[model samples]
Target: MSFRIVDLAETGSTNDWIADHPEDGLWVRADRQTAGRGRRARAWTSDIGNLFTSTFAAPQPGEGAAPQLSFVAANALLDTVARWVPRERLSLKWPNDLMLDGMKVAGILLEGHARGVIIGVGVNLAHFPEGTERPATSLAAAGIAPPSAREACGTLAEAFAAHRRRWREDGFAATRADWLAAAAGIGKPIVARLGNADLTGTFEGLAEDGALLLRLPDGALRPIHAGEVFTLGDQA
Candidate 1:
């Protein structure tokens, strides 16, 4: 499906903009954001040369459509970035963040409104924020000249449509398998901070419904529906 792209010189946030102007098949992008944000309302530094966009789509009738779409978005991002970066150096962090060599290169945020769900994506093209909880990297810092925001959005829209088609036809199992194959921190020790409590465990993988399966020290398993994860040795 072709998406209607609305390019903005500056905005508060693509996600917020799309939220206020709810419409299906719309892709809203801004060259610079005055109020960009990430998960848990963390302020995202909107440098002049990065990709900040949001796409709106109606949720499929199902219990897990939101989480399933998150996986679809991740796969689409992986497909787009893999063209310029080596596949071996890139991995999808569970739920949203995309990593390049263990550092965050991109982030995805999904918000539901009266009209549809908005998939907000921010990629570090020419610059990355400093002093973040997790270390961040950019395509330019990784030695490849980053694509223009418009070019990257074009690639993302195409890739997202392809993955969405696959999800519609093949279902979540297929997307889950693909996401797991490209997942980072699986089989490694990690910490999950779920609001007030923190749990340290081994990253087993994902459950069928897309919840994170974390095996604790006692050998029991915990399904984390939401949290911030950190690979054991990485700075968080």
Candidate 2:
């Protein structure tokens, strides 16, 4: 399906734009976002030269749950970035982050809207935020020339559509498999901050339904549906 893409010089947030517009197959990409944010409502550094875009995903019957779209988006973003950067330098972090060389390079946010789900994506093209909780990197930082925001959005839109189709046709089984293959930190020790508590365990993989599979010290596998994940670097 063709997307009605709106390229803006600036916006408060692409996700919020889609939230208000709610048009199926509509996409909003901004050169700069005045109020961009990631999961848990953390402020996102939306400077020019980065890719800030959001697209609406109309509800589809028999498709995986809305939250599972996070993986779909992650796969798409991974493909998009790999177009410019070496694939081996990239990996998808649990929940909604794309890691480049163990530092965050991209983030995905799926927000439920009245019409469907709004998949917001932010990629560090030429710049990344400094003094953040976790280390961040960008395409330029890795010594690769970054794509223009518009160009990156075009690639992302195509990748997202393709991945979404796979999710609808092949089901979450295939999508889950693809995500796991490129997932970061599998079998590595990490910490998950769960609001009132923090759990440190080995990153096993993802559960059948997209929950994180964390192996506790006792060897019991725990399914984490929601929480902020901190890699060993972040803990250090």
Candidate 3:
């Protein structure tokens, strides 16, 4: 794996850049992403102190990663954070966000094509920035203070690489177990927001393929393959 760090970048969309490069195990990171973005094309503010990165993976067919590469990326991050922060303090907030003490600290977004998968990650290292619609957080604010951006990236990248290698061996079942160990709301009452409709249930953890197991109010455990779920927050 090779890493290329640029001081600044025009766009936060790593999937776009990796698509053109397609270099095996290539990583692109920018301290400032002028048009940093998130899921649904929301504005992702990339300040000089934050960590914004995108990585490319040479594709493999019949692997658990084809349609659900995001889970793999999330698991890698969870593993990485667990090494630096206590498991109790670090939690995988469903699909992709890495939450610490109930505030979002990092996020992963994956885009794929016939050739490979592009994994984009944004981390708030310094200030979480005010004026966001959702509550946000940062590593420095969460007691992992004074850590350099380069140091955090190096640690996270190492963890991600190991986690990803294991994922290729064990598939999503193994990934599900690893993710559950670090998830925040497991076994707790959680609400799944599905835009117009919402499902209230207890977080029963994850299924074999990474779908959520929500024990609904009716006491029936439902398998939810799609929907944003979190504690107290309405899914959108």
Among all candidates shown, the one with the greatest lDDT: 2
Candidate 1 runs further than 4 Å off = 61-64
TM-score order of candidates, top first: 2, 1, 3
**What pairs collide in candidate 1?**
none
Candidate 3 deviant stretches above 4 angstroms: 1-12, 233-236
Per residue, candidate 2 scores C-alpha lDDT tens digits across 153-235 of: 99998998899899999999999999999998898999998988989999999999999999999999999999888876676
lDDT of each: 0.89, 0.91, 0.73
The ten-residue window of minimal lDDT in model 1 covers 59-68
Instruction: List pairs with backbone clashes in candidate 2.
Output: none
Worst 10 residues of 3 by lDDT: 1-10
Better of 1 and 3 by TM-score: 1
Model 2 residue 151 distance off true place after TM-score fit, in angstroms: 0.6
TM-score each candidate: 0.96, 0.97, 0.88
Q: Compose the digit string of candidate 3's lDDT tens values, residues 1-236.
A: 44544434456455677677777566777767767778767788777788777777776543564546677778777666666677788778877899888888888877775677778888887868777756788877877763566666676667667666667777777767777777888788888877678888898988777778999878898988776776855433
* Backbone steric clashes in candidate 3, count: 0
Can you write out model 1's per-residue Cα lDDT over 26-126, one digit (the tens) per residue?
Answer: 89999999999998888989998899999988866442466578999999999998888899999999889899988999999988788668899999999
Candidate 3: Cα lDDT at 64: 66
